[model samples]
Target: MADNNLWHETLHDHFGQYFAVDNVLYHEKTDHQDLIIFENAAFGRVMALDGVVQTTERDEFIYHEMMTHVPLMAHGQAKHVLIIGGGDGAMLREVSRHRTIETITMVEIDAGVVSFCRQYLPNHNAGAYDDPRFTLVIDDGVNFVNQTTQTFDVIISDCNRPYWSRREPVHLGLLRRLQTLPESRRHFCGPKRGLLSAAG
Candidate 1:
């Protein structure tokens, strides 16, 4: 909540962080999540979903580049890439930088996240959304993986943590589905912290 000019992120009961808001750009409850975008002197623009910080303008390159480049570089001949739940467009931006990749498909559950982030967080996407190689699908990532007939050389999962209501981690479930792909080289990259495990 915005108290005075500061926005407090109570991600945990006992521990939280505060970012001084230079301006409150957008705040609303979308169909799938609560979204907020605000400007900060340090972070430039900050986006929070369900009261948890998701991305920032200032250092987005660090996370985006690492998650994108590391796996792509490792899978040297990757021509097709799939991304799950990167609604902010940062992942697309990084992935599109590769001239070798012929197709880039991103599946995001929330359309609203894409709408506002495109407007308020343009720097994150940087016109990657318009690239001819890109395709955006509004659907659940898990279901997309389970049903997709298409194949990808590299798959990146840039999603938020699993819902607290669910008993199992969503990444693990997605990983299981990824394994069913034909016996060939498949590279998978997920969130680096506690949320995901990399598989190749």
Candidate 2:
């Protein structure tokens, strides 16, 4: 019994140390949400939704600037933009920097993600969620893209490849819908562009 107790104590201590170094423990009591907090040295206490790290104090600018500037500079004069799967609103905050952008639409499937980001990751989004020019849609990104008759000057795919790949049917359906759009040019970011083209 003493040996078993010692082993259990060792295991507990190991797990506690791992959690202390790697993640911030947020007590999640909500019925429909996964809340996490990261004890990041630079970002301090960082809160995230659904186990996804939205941003850290150390590297938010790098991601925001890269995601925004690369495409905005490439297009040169984008007046409207569409973002698929960036529920964190970081991309929206970046897109708002360009004065040329008149409208920005963000489509994310999880409303919970958006709500959580608004509460936790305020620095990343910069309160762009409430902007009048920004339209937030809580729906399947593909369905949102398919039904829209309006074509954007630029479309930013801000989703993770692995997650989108897991939902192949939805991703493929969206690609097919995008092909039907009148726009001659389509630009895709992230790792799943090949799958997108295949679906198209």
Candidate maximizing lDDT: 1
Candidate 1 global TM-score: 0.86
lDDT of 1 by residue, 1-200 (tens): 77899888664558778999899899999999999999999999999888778899999998899898988887777788888888999999999999998999999999999999999999999999999999999999899877777767777888876344346666678877656655542333322211232322
In candidate 1, clashing pairs total 0
lDDT of 1 at 92: 96
Question: Would you give me the overall lDDT of model 2?
Answer: 0.61
**lDDT (0-100) at residue 88 of candidate 2?**
72
Cα-based lDDT for every prediction: 0.82, 0.61
lDDT assessment of candidate 1? 0.82
**In model 2, which range of ten residues has the least summed lDDT?**
1-10
* lDDT of each residue in 1-200, candidate 2, tens digit only: 01221111122324411222244444363454565545555455454444434456567777768777787787676777888877777788888888778988888877766776677667768978877789988877777776666667667777633342245655556667656655443433221231221110
C-alpha RMSD for every candidate: 4.7, 8.0
The estimated TM-scores of all candidates read 0.86, 0.67
Per-residue lDDT, model 1, residue 15, is: 74
